[model samples]
Target: MSSNAELHTLKQRTDNYAYVLRCRETGLCAVIDASEPDSVLELLARIDGRLSLILNTHHHPDHTAANPELVARTGAPVLAAPWSGHAGSGPDITLKDGDPIILGRLRGTVLATPGHTLSDLCFWFEADRLLFTGDTLFSMGCGRLFEGTARQMWASLTRLRALPADTLVLCGHDYTLGNIAFARSLDPHNAALLEWEATVRARKAVGALPPHPTLGLEARANPFLRADDPDIQKSLDMPGADPSDVFAEIRRRKDHFTA
Candidate 1:
């Protein structure tokens, strides 16, 4: 309630992050994704097993693989999108768009973001200005449209873009380096993109993943978020095209991008 929440970003084998959120006042905890049972168990042990909830951003195997094991171990109920295609036990709490999630004194709202999957959801803690974005919205790029349409993905991203500029984005994967390379290709002359690329390279050189960036930084440096920019549109050879059309072209190119 006071925005004094502790979030532990646990990196899994797939470069995916499983966020462990705890309320300082109540000692209540919840996890964002359960990629690995061992990792989740270890984290819960470190926190003295205070876990009370398990929420999945989507139903991808890599994201929801450990749900059943974790639920058996901690008895924490699973919360996921209503249309979730969970392979494990079904969700105990089916979350719809804009549903409220309560964890002790902390409260978060669920945002339906269909793109990578029709059931993708982003969890937003407004008081703390924190967002746990799944595959839908990444740092410098958005997720591939595996189930939904490019138009749907673009709309979903636009929704995220409307959030507070200072919101801290905790994306599901550590794909920043690759995404930055793609962003630089389109906006070669963007000073902000260049600066951010240097910082990202420095972090990787030391065997570290890029730090989570704020919404403000992403809005300026991320090509996917800046699909409406004249530079990106020109790069795609689609000047004056609908922003969603431009976004679709970018996503198509990214699908085959090696970098």
Candidate 2:
């Protein structure tokens, strides 16, 4: 199989799971979450387009640390949710639900996804069939239960999963290795997960990032997505209950994942 690079100036700095997206032809790019100062500037300088927008998935520093500096350097328009006050963002353009934007020749639309945070949003480039999942949804798992409930995250994941299967998911970070490791723990017997782990390990071994752009169907096989599946409830020592309740319990277990 061949690699298809979606955005021309797309680069991922795994330091804090931060990714940068810039349009090549226009010299106009949007930094998804700027973490490392030099790394982001290096990519920005290399790109032909001028920096026109800096977007923050949420107010996390690792994702927003370079926002002020990037904005100052390029005088680019900083766009973020209305409530993500002082993510070092101070975006000139505040985006809300259903807002459509034209970046260079690409059309970008905002989906007000608020599971990770009340103001978190995802950017969708319909023509290109690219969806930036941010911290909301990962290749194998979902975000933490920070400001929202399991129900909200569940709904958000469902909505995103509903997008066309071909929609390329450009999530915020490269947490694939770690996330898959956790997934393996829950369903150690899942052959699909075992096979995935082997491939991801090989990729990471070769210094190749393994942030899989998995289709919605592939994720369905993941126990994490089956937050409400009856089989999942059985594994969690519960059965015959509301899906939301099952989801909440699963999130509680995940909260203790790193521990």
Best by lDDT: 1
Pairs with backbone N, CA or C atoms under 3 Å apart (clashes), candidate 2: 27-48, 27-49, 27-50, 28-49
Report the C-alpha lDDT of model 2 over 60-160, residue by residue, as the tens digit. Answer: 77667777777768887767776545554356788898898666666788988877887778887776777777788776667787788777877877677
Q: In model 2, how large is the Cα lDDT of residue 191? A: 71
What are the per-model C-alpha RMSD values against the true structure? 1.7, 3.0
Instruction: Report clashes for each candidate as comma-separated counts.
Output: 0, 4
Over the full model, what C-alpha lDDT does candidate 2 score relative to the true structure?
0.69
TM-score of 1: 0.95
* Residue pairs whose backbone atoms clash in candidate 1: none
Model 2, stretches more than 4 Å misplaced?
1-15, 84-86
User: Which run of 10 residues does model 1 get worst, by summed lDDT?
Assistant: 81-90
Model 1 C-alpha lDDT per residue in residues 1-259, reported as the tens digit of each score: 2456888888897688888999877878899876888887887778764889999998887888888888888898999986533365568989989999998888899999988888899999999888999898888888999999988898998899999998989998888878988887788778877888788889889988777888888899888887888878888899999998999999998988886
Whole-structure CA lDDT of model 1: 0.86
TM-scores of the candidates are 0.95, 0.86
